[model samples]
Target: LGNTIVFPYSYKSSYKSNLLGSSTSPIQDVNMEEEFELKDGDVVTEVVDGIPTIIFFDQVHKYIERRMAKTIIMKLLGRSIGFNVLLKKITSLWCPRSPIQLMDLENDYYLIRFNSEDDYNKVVFGGPWVIFGQYLTVRLWSKDFSTSQSKVDTQLVWVRLPGLPEGFYSDFLIRAIGQLLGQVVKLDAHTNSARKGRFARLVVLIDLKKPLMSKIKINGRIQRIKYKSLPIICFSVWHVWT
Candidate 1:
């Protein structure tokens, strides 16, 4: 009922009486009858710029508030998976503590509502989630989301600097090297402590359209780069797979 304007009986009577006083009322009774015969529960819409726009009152906010913390939107990049298949695969992969609800949205997008906040957080922070060899992009739901124009251009990926010298494990040096691939998001715990000598792991935000860097020259020596959970591409048919 917040921010919703309700006309009481007196107000409606007063308005009708005031209209009767005028010989030529701008708003006629017939027009009023046609427009204001509102039901107890009806979705209200008004014309705005020649387009019908829904009028959401405080009640809408209440509904949104209930689900805001536990709702997320997801889209699979470069591929479309059946709803049943995707649901089954994701349910098994995520294994949420409580049940989850999935709703199909426009443009291969899906809405997920989790019963528990812990499940929501796990899904939100757990990926670079991949399904059917395609990246499943997960994002917190927003009011301004538009499926038609939205595009998945960037993604968080774990990159490995294999055979890197132990001396280069310093925070400053590792971050500097990580820049060669993309924006360095964070260093893996073991990599930060240099406990894992085999390779240094860093989470990087990379552009999907750009060709991934295979190697970088540091001090005139080449260092090989490896990506975890990267999709494999078949050169013959240009099909990507896990």
Candidate 2:
């Protein structure tokens, strides 16, 4: 339903028809290597309208888990926010030539499909990313992604801290937090004057050499870190094998 925020995996088709379009044509089955094959590069091709069509190249969808609406709203405002906000943010990315398919699995994960490979690449390669005031942790969705070890050398982690004590901004504090967590990528701080004194807010996006499941508390205030993702593998295959 249009109003539903979460649903079981079986609902994907019906949901797609209503929200995206009714373009679920079936592809003829094709054979794959009897044994599992490790492939290089991230893209696949299909024959559509007598032309070769390039697709996401990756079998699974990649997205930012910590940037999802529910988890982010809970971590930042400490409450659940409406799904419409998330939809609006995603749709605003661009006006597409064809409807882009999006589904929030409610596992702090989302899946997106674009009609054009160009649009998909723009999203995948574009930099300086943020969603609803939080830094995004992007990844490809796959069963093996979570456990893959040959990922890029550095992965950026987004963090937000509220209710900092007055005059708490200092290099020492930033470096200390990074040391406690991972390498520092970017830092953001906002200061506002209050009747009593000035209070400050801080946000940090760090580069993690590896995935860490640690939490940090600064001056009794717990900071929510938004950096966790699965492994990514790239390969090019025929659509019939999808």
Candidate 3:
């Protein structure tokens, strides 16, 4: 049984009888015991309802550490997208160092594995990605992730404050203005340094269920808000359409 992968099983006194099945083979019985022996912290037990529950802690840890570190879980909000289409679009957009593996999960969720950590970080921290006029919500993969229970209502969107006063470029002031739109996630380097005067750019986590703010008033002056890759919205009916 050397180098053979043994599956986890419950320990019982009749385990030898079950494996032998009336055959009196001492060697076979010894091999069976060796195969199922709990050794080297390979298996951990927890008492549940007066029964020991076996946990393959080492196997699970290795799987997650090697496989899931550069993996991300994502889902397209308010729409169902095909696997091939999503793969094609995101591959082209991300331009990863190596080809990515895309797997479709339960519900509308998708799992993406990247070969490079740089690619993973870029996609995770990247803008509220928009595909086919719909927002793509992205999150890091966790061991206890559930497709049905995971719901996304907010996205990190880039908002441009046009004609923002030069004095408002300070980090504190910009963040304060960003609160009017949504939770401030980050500020563009150029915007924070005041190198770009056209508009102040910052990333905000905006709620998708609410109407997006088109303009904001500052010091009794109207400042128009520009959203990047935003879906079409009908102001008359206050309805947003993808």
Q: Highest TM-score: which candidate?
A: 3
Which 10 consecutive positions of candidate 2 have the poorest summed lDDT?
25-34
Give the Cα error of residue 90 in candidate 2, in Å: 1.8
By lDDT, the candidates rank as 3, 1, 2
Tell me the alpha-carbon RMSD of every candidate: 15.1, 16.2, 12.5
Q: What is the lDDT of residue 26 in candidate 3?
A: 32
- Ordered list by TM-score, greatest first: 3, 1, 2
Model 3 pairs whose backbones collide: none
Per-candidate TM-score against the hidden true structure: 0.55, 0.32, 0.57
In model 1, where do residues sit more than 4 Å from their true spots? 1-73, 82-85, 98-103, 111-146, 149-151, 233-242
lDDT of 2 by residue, 1-242 (tens): 23322211112344544344334411000101022233455457789999989765342233223222112111111123345565556556544444444544442344554445565544543433456555444443333433233222333334443444555566466556666665453444333232332332223333334345344677677765433322231223111100
Q: Mind giving the per-residue lDDT tens digits that candidate 1 earns over 1-242?
A: 00111111111123444334343432232123222333445457789999989876665655656535567777887888776677778877888766565656677777776666788767865676878777887766767667674565455667899999999988889999999888886788899899999999987876656767778899999999888745553323433331
| Alpha-carbon lDDT, every model | 0.66, 0.39, 0.68
- Top candidate by lDDT: 3
Query: Looking at candidate 2, what is the lDDT of residue 232?
Result: 31
